[model samples]
Target: MLLQIDLQKEEPIYMQIVHQIIEGIAKNELKPGDDLPSVRSLGADIGINFHTVNKAYQILKQEGFILIHRQKGVVIHPDAAYLANAAYVEKLKRDIRPIIAEAAARNLPIREMEKLVETLYNEMKGE
Candidate 1:
């Protein structure tokens, strides 16, 4: 899996790592049981600190997106699909609430926001 990190972006490096890894799963680029680079290795590859990569990995593991093993290392969660439950939906809503609020505050039409979401969804799915 490849993660592209933009140092100039507003989001933190660790968040970028988290988002891209999740996107890779969505795109079918990273499958269940697929091995991921070690935190130190990935950090060096992406030109970031090891702790940043570790933070992202810990979050992914906590959220059921990845699994960490002492010998096998890290891999996509075998039962990752179960992550899309009601609680996940609620969390998703909470996460995107700020963006939706900003769009509303800016007077962007609902249709436009819907289109934006559709476009991003398709792109993430590699459609």
Candidate 2:
């Protein structure tokens, strides 16, 4: 997977890594069971500390996005389908509500927001 990082961004480097990996999965650039580069290797490639990559990998493992094997290293989770359980839905709402509210505050129309979401969904699905 190709990861792009901006040191100037306020977001942490590890989060930038996490978000890009998730986007790669969403865009089907990374498939289930695909082996990710070793943390040291990735860090060297991206010019970051290995610990930063390790932190991102740990977060991904905790979130069921990837698995770390002693022998095989890191691989994408084979069963990574998101479960839309109540807790997940609530979390999703909590995460997205502020963004939607910001859009509304900026006077972005509801229809425009809906279209934007639809476009993003379609893009994710490679439509």
Among these predictions, the greatest lDDT belongs to 2
Model 2: per-residue Cα lDDT over 42-114, one tens digit each:
9999999999999999999998999999999999999766766898789899999999999989999999999
- Per-residue lDDT tens digits for candidate 1, residues 1-127, read 7788999999999999999999998888998999999999998887889999999999999989999999999999998656477888899999999999999999999999999999999997788
**In candidate 1, which residue pairs clash?**
none
How many Å off is the CA of 65 in candidate 1?
A: 0.7
Q: Which ten residues in a row have the lowest lDDT in candidate 1?
A: 79-88
Clashing pairs in 2: none
Task: Please tell me which predicted candidate would have the highest TM-score against the true structure.
Answer: 2
